[model samples]
Target: MLGKAWQFARRHKTKIAAVSAITGGLVLAGKLAESKFKQWQEEETRKMLEQIKKQHHYENTEKTSNETLKSLFPALIKTIEKSLDSEPILERIKNQTGNKIELWNELKVLSFARALAMIITGTQLVLLLKLQLNILSGILYIKQPSQVLSSRLQERFMALSQNFISFSVPKICEQIREKMIQLLALSLKEKFTITQLEAFFQTTLLQLDLPGFQKLIIAPDGDHISQPLNPDEHLLLDDLINNIVELLEHEDYAKIFRIGLQTSLSNVFDYLAESYLSHESYKENGLRSEVRLPVAKLIPILNQSITVYQSVLHALIKHYTIREYSANIYESFCQAPPDAIAKPSLSTLWPF
Candidate 1:
């Protein structure tokens, strides 16, 4: 049997070898195909996960940016709220200048320019506050009266709005004036010598253009045309300054200013409240339930006020010191400047 099988195997050896080789090749091909398929699947999965991760990161970054922009205005309001209180300003002045007597001496002459600034600031603040209150009341009563906020809630909000306004108006005015002074100082091309500064002050003091100033403050488009003061208005301005200087000499000048500021603030608030908050619906008799105001709602109103006030303040400052008018002063400051050898002391930009 072995001999017969051997002889058969030898006779068909080539065919048998061919069949064995074909089977081995098929198994190897199958294994290679499986390995390639696994590699392809892994690559596809990695790409998909990476794509998703990138999308998520982009979305998060965009959301963060939007949130930051949204918060900026409110943050400004909060900063003003925290920093510009009457108490803080008074304390700061006291700490800087010590006694009222010291303050009086330091401020005696310096207060003239500052007095002009204060007068303008006080007037503008009152107008801005009224405008802000009106807009806020409009939003509460007209725009979002029903949706998100109920009418009853609107009335409650109005009632509480005064406290916010009363607290904020004075502080905001101070903050703005502080910014105005800083900006004015920074915008100058160079430091002024005492002689040049005094000359500049004398030249420009009475020449402040009221019509031009008012135009800049109220105009939507910022027009900073350098305007000169007329003879009559110059006299009036002089008188005003004189009156302020006389008032400053009084021992209770600070107290008087505070009282006047508070009075003006109250009057503006009262006028606006009468106009906006006197809703016919609020007069109707009903069970008076208290409405709680969300801080979120108040922010938008405050932000609007801040925006308007800031813009106006900037406009006024630029108008007050437009390069066209200021060039004369600048030229004087620059031409044939004092020798460094003779005057060893540094020339101060601010006179006071």
Candidate 2:
């Protein structure tokens, strides 16, 4: 039996070696396959993480822009507050080489200019916001194709803008003119000193809370409900606020809106400065504190300055709210995939 087993072992040597080699190769191949699988999995995970990072960055940018738009009114108000600081105005007077008595009159004109800037800027912000809100309300509940919706919405927004310029501006300006007359007459009768007028202007301008005005303009229980709107229309207004806000969050619209609004405001400031400097009385007397304020003349000048900005506002509204631009915002929302759109909390029709 031992002799037979020894012979069998010797004969099977090559067969045993070949079988051993095959087993070893199979083990190595298994390890290689497992390693490749892990590499592929890691690569996929990295790609997914990158996508998520990109998405978060995009969302954050939009959110930041939207918040900036929302806070613009307050931001501009603060800017005016800083620009009109009494110290700087007084400093300008001190630095002047001309007669101090003549320079003193300049304070009244300067203060008036600053006050008008605040009022006009505030009014424009409010009016623009109101126009946007009204446009949103008009288009919110409409059921139509994107192209048709966009065209109709643009027409509606433009019509509202025209109405605002034609009817609203004059009426609002009249009220403003009357208020200015009263304020100026009272100041003159009291013989407000240059320092005292500066103080008054600063106090009055700083008291303007643009956000407070916004809340009054849009709040559900506020004066905007003078007309009897249906329940759905009321709800639509709330939804429209959200939609318009989200629309402004689009980066393109946000950038353009900011630039246009800032440009318009700057133009108004430049006009006011030029008008004041060119005034015959202003050039002659140099803003004499003792001089009577040309209240009637100043009111019309301020009204004209404010009226010119309406054109810029119209251009802005037309540029962004039209069908061509509106389609882009809708396209952006579509990029989020159908599954994301179907989610209840994320379901928003964000268009102008």
Best by lDDT: 2
User: What would the per-residue lDDT of candidate 1 be over residues 139-177, giving only the tens digit for each residue?
Assistant: 222233344334433233222223333343344445444
Query: Each candidate's lDDT (Cα)?
Result: 0.36, 0.45
Instruction: Please give, for residues 123-203, the per-residue lDDT of candidate 2 as tens digits.
Output: 444334443533332232232325223443333332332333333433433333344444543422243333343455445
Best by TM-score: 2
Query: In candidate 2, which residue pairs clash?
Result: 105-287, 105-288, 105-289, 106-287
Total backbone clashes of model 1? 0
Return the lDDT, model 1, position 151: 42
C-alpha TM-score for every candidate: 0.24, 0.34
Candidate 1: minimum summed lDDT over ten consecutive residues — where? Answer: 340-349
What's model 1's overall lDDT?
A: 0.36
What are the per-model numbers of colliding residue pairs? 0, 4
